[model samples]
Target: MSVCKHIRNQGYSQREFLVLRRWAIYPHPSVPHYTNKLFTHHELQHSDYLSQLCIGYRHILFWARWVVTVIWRCIFCAYHKLFGRKYTPLPPIEDLALVQSATTLAEWIRRGKRSAESVVRAYIHRIQTVNATLNALVDERFAAALEEAREVDHRLASLTKQEREALADSHPLLGVPFTCKDNIKLTDMNHTGGIVSRRGIKAEQDAVVVARLRMAGAVPLGVSNVPELAMWCETSCTMYGRTNNPYDVTRTPGGSSGGEAALLSSCGTALSIGTDVGGSIRIPSFCCGTFGHKPTSGWVSLEGAGLFPDALNDSFGIQVVGPMCRCARDLTLALQVMAPHAAKDLASKVQHTDLRDLKFWWCEGLDTPLCSPLDPALRHALTAATHYLSTTFEAPLEKLEWPRDMSIATLMWNNKLRDDYRGQPPMTVDMTNRKGRVSLLAEGLRWLCGRGRFTFPLLMMATFQKLLAVNEDPQDSPHYWKPMQEFLMGTLGKTGVLLLPTLPQLAFLHHEFVPNMLDFGHTCIFNTTEMPVTAVPLGLSKDRLPLGLQVVVSPGQDHISLAVAQALEDKFGGWVSPVPVTV
Candidate 1:
């Protein structure tokens, strides 16, 4: 490849401009940079000059797209400014804090470099100012939070420096503020689950996830809002008004985790928690332009989730309690703090882990019974991610086949056996056994037996009450359960990890239904797989809404998932604050 040919191939014209000797040689002190720097007069030939012209033409064509991309982004931002959603009294820039790879907000607070009182006060003030409009937070725990901050500060003052450092590493969340989906129970707070029936009810004990977060030193700002029964995608309930996107108030923040997403995106809080039976966490994160994670079922203890009081006994399949944040580091940080695991056990596991050595499989599109086209922006983001991921590992990228029959199993586990079943259609249509009848009775019976019960009528009544009490569909259990097992045993037959788009579109209109709500098959399928899935923010949508990706790893391999999420963040832009500086 002579310099002249390279230039011609790059699309430079012959005779129009000579390739001077100074241009072709290296280290020319100064001879007009750009094209001239790569070629010299002696190296140029008539044959090569033609090729250089072609090369130059191609370069122009390639960079032209980038120019268009920037122009498009500018136009989108301007439109959002003019007629899209808007927020009042934008938050101060100082409130923004970047979460470290494996430390939760609480951990950030506990680090003591930042005042717990300052963090708590900032969030409390933000909530007071903006929440009324967004309606993202249903309950405010400001007084209690102040008291907790006082205690945290007192404790930190008493500790020696080394002890403080060790404690910060162990419990980084000590003073950080956070919020959780209303569906999860936190002692002393109402566990609405977005249902009017449960309005007055408060948890008798912290849900396991809540307890873990508290243990890590996080102060609760209050319970964030969610959709009714968390069954819908937009964040609106009889108890709380709809949550709107911070980028554009008219558009939806994304649900069932919309509240958390909205609050975090607006800088009302640094990090938060969201539950995903389907796309609750990822949807809101993507819409709000943040990050969220849906861990494998049972990876995070569901013992205290307000939904289906008996999470252990019910077959609630796809439902998972996970972290949602504006930054990928915050997602991993929240996961480590909330998921049920002994500190000693996790400590031992973290001793011998390396992210670079891991294997990751990227699946942008799936061929399945629930196939649908992804939005152009989302598609491009996922494809770009796949390209970037290849360099992380020294292995080939393989496209995995989606099992057509898998959705049937997923529907069953996600919808069929929910504790809240009140004659509603299950999330999946697989209520029929192989015999082809809606033989859900047998499955329900098995559910009772799985909980160690055999009586049909009494068990049915108990299930019904559980459903009513927690406001979860009793049918979703079977809908998510069977399919999850099948998905794990089948397509994911391999041992490593997989990646996929978090949602098909950008943040949707506030209170609008996804054009095709059922397409969340991508997210729900993983919920069925019951594997720990890490949601990492890749970038913004073509329209400036957030876009994210989920990394699904084998069950109980949470450490690996966290590692992979951290690695992805290292390579891509994880979370960017919605607040922008005018200067």
Candidate 2:
């Protein structure tokens, strides 16, 4: 048998075999290069002594390479820890226009207190000045937005005072500049979801929500960035790149709506539309210290949101399109514009439950291993939020125990999502090879060598999906989900709200989220249960990073969550502008 035959028999590919041969024959100059010609020659392929020597050399090289790689990673991490840029103290905000909520901005524009063009220009100038450091806006329609703003001015000017009042009542968001998550289609903008391959793919028409917002007289400024396929909890991709938290440029803004959250945090846009299935909207809101809402499933249409094929079925009645904004009032305004049919009935019927009449349940943390212990700051924030609500509303707060089977329930929901892509191309990893199936070990090695193109979190999700795909039913298990859903709904029925931690910690440093992915369970659980949740900012931490809590209510009770969020916002200064960090 020849050396090539030996490698083939050992299950190594021709390419891999050749590479190994080269490495063994030409070992690093600093290391001993095995100079035995017999080891390289086919003539000695069958010789037991030479074969054993070659095997031993290969093993030694493998271990040596791994050790060196580990050492390099350690050094890289250490260097970043020492020299990486962090967020600096923010300057006092002098521009009241920048901090004004969408509702207030619209009111000003409608009342002739501010011109539409001026408001739009102020945001454009701010975005231009800070976007270089934040990288929040992936696409800008500034020129078009300005033109639209001018048109809005002309329209308002043409109307009499009585007509303007009527228009304001009808078009509440009129002339307000807002943004859309890149995944939420805005006609002619890239709907890339931060995937390099999807760049330049423009939406032919606005998404349902986008269309409605446009009709409501709001000008679309542009689209924001997201993680690839909108998969991770941190915003980054090879296309538009990573978005930094305006509060701390070194920390993540969270994802897949991270860019929108960062933009809102920086006051680049007063209100933005984002989608959430597994906490995409709320997590970013928490990280950026902005308000976000995930409406009851099916409240907002998913049309024109660039989801993966067949995702609608898997995530049916689970994912939703909602709003992220600087103020909770804007959430109700945006939701009304986006989901008018549902909002009309829900908004009118949504009587504000007095704090005295409302029941409050708080869970400091989850019972599952998937969740990390809450950061001390986050715990304090939650506690403070609870106390404020309790004292102000005179609402009694009780500790609620998380379901012991919550982890498995989450997994079962995810398993159903995975089945949607069953015969499609694998998302991040290529499991199929010319030889046969590729091992995850080999793929991981390829990733370490910089040969893999996928991001680490994406690869991890792909691996998870592949593992869960086995023996997983395409249909969701009602046995697991039904009872869980019923229990959650029953607990929060009518006038009850659940206060839960939005995330285990504040926005992590970029690339630091790979290990902390499991902590996402904090938000994802509500998604699984199809509950409406409002992510309410609890002001900045002592370190100036954002802290927050999730206000969860039963399905169709979006107004309940939003109301709670507003009360919290009023008590705790909401959405403080991050002190701009120099890149």
Candidate 3:
């Protein structure tokens, strides 16, 4: 295949590859374990094992031919870049008049000061005004939202004083407006999930996450866009288009939670839900200035979602449903309602988790299989953040040694991805394709390597670990796999949270990834590790885009991370609203 055809069949170019890499698709400088030597694809040329597994490249050839047919389309983009109209201006932050903190937003509805109808309508208007430029909401339910809001208002009007208070007190999220990943099911919305083939499938029942959100009295505004099957980081799907960052329309909002992040950044919804199998939630939250929580596995239900749901095996431990919002407290609020609980008893009494006595283990490096090099601004921001945390909290942050066996985790995650793929239909692998070759052979090597020590099932399970991959972003290098829990637990004593940069860089132009090699640097490691990570926006980068910090708590220790987030927010106003007078 010609280079262009080869690139086209990849569904993206080397430029696209670099773009995805920078957006956390591959290793970067921050992830210390990601060595350039390992990514040297030439090393794989000698693997006889790979030659044995090569398969037909017909489909790739077809896509390549199609790509060649459409190569001229690039001229349109080039013409536009050179002389076409500039981007549409973002709504001036000043245009925003009514601002609601997560706390105040909920309180307004509870106090009957702002009817759900009005609140939802206001958001609908905001989405209407902004979504054209952002492509944030894949499908909107304005009519249904209004009806639901009206019903909520009417119910409030008819309730007795005690009844109203009881009802209000019951659903903290009552009358609040929210949205979720299109991969997630809602009653009327088509659950496209950015996959064209799945674009027309209407959900018969709400996904467990949606059901929980609605049962808390929240109205679903609509479904947000996501990546194709949420496979890539930047949220561009052939079906719904790309979701832009609120900070810079030219930049990606990050995915597979990009749409939700964009919506949250624009204040289009009070709260939203997103799934994270491999940094899907955290990366978007990092890209768009927002607070997102990836709760511990099984803390929230993933029963009805479609984006890579099969990956969650009976013993699978990497995926989760989490909240995305603009404030730290909002995350806490969302988590309470979202935690696995009956709809009637959604109130979370798990508050007051103090941070004063918390122990923290700060991991400064990217700690992935990629070299996660941070932008200078991101580095400065992170340095400032570390200084503030150590100085203000009077808590000396200790730096932990880098784990050596991190690739073990990446290998495990590769196996998980392979198993997930195999569990699905048509288990065909044309290993002739570079991507397939890497996935299949890497998984096989892991399985074969461990056969001496494990049973068939156990060996397979061991092949795909929930461990942190340190050698490279699992998606980038054939060798990018690692398992590091034994090391982490050994060093950190299995307590306190691990603090790191949410990403190595601030948001960049949409195609910046074209030139960079960094891939899902920090976030994917956690996905592989199956650890709970909370991403909180720290402040804007020098370039004016958002910078976020991540806190990784021991599995099931999400509460501790939230406490730290809350404390950090208090110290450094988390998720600062842009000067809210949008033009």
Index of the highest-TM-score prediction: 2
Off by over 4 Å in 3: 1-85, 93-98, 307-315, 341-351, 367-372, 405-412, 419-422, 425-483, 514-518
Q: Which segments of model 1 are wrong by more than 4 Å?
A: 1-92, 96-112, 311-317, 340-359, 368-372, 405-495, 581-583
**TM of each candidate vs. truth:** 0.70, 0.80, 0.74
Worst 10 residues of 1 by lDDT: 426-435
- Top candidate on lDDT is 2
On residues 255-324, what C-alpha lDDT tens digit does candidate 2 reach at each position?
Answer: 9999999888887888889988788999899999999999888878888886453444424756788999
For candidate 1, write residues 375-406 as lDDT tens digits. 67777777777677666565456664442223
What does candidate 3's lDDT look like per residue over 1-583, in tens digits? 3223433464543444333232232333234454423323343345434323222332354355345424433544464467643556556543232356556766777678888888888889888878888899988789988999898888888877677667644677778889998888888787765543455778788987788778878989998988666655678755676678888776789888899999888878878899887788988898888889888767787777764445444245567789998877777677767774422222242255645455666655544333334456766666776677667766657775552323233344554454334434221121111123224345456647763211222223222332422334344554434334433444444456678777665664564443332445467667766678899788886667888788887776676777777777877777866435644
- Cα error, candidate 1, residue 56 (Å): 42
What ranking emerges by lDDT with the best candidate at the front?
2, 3, 1
> Every model's Cα RMSD, please?
16.9, 15.8, 13.6
Would you give me the overall lDDT of model 1? Answer: 0.61
Global CA lDDT computed for model 2: 0.75
Looking at candidate 2, the ten consecutive residues that score lowest on lDDT are 26-35
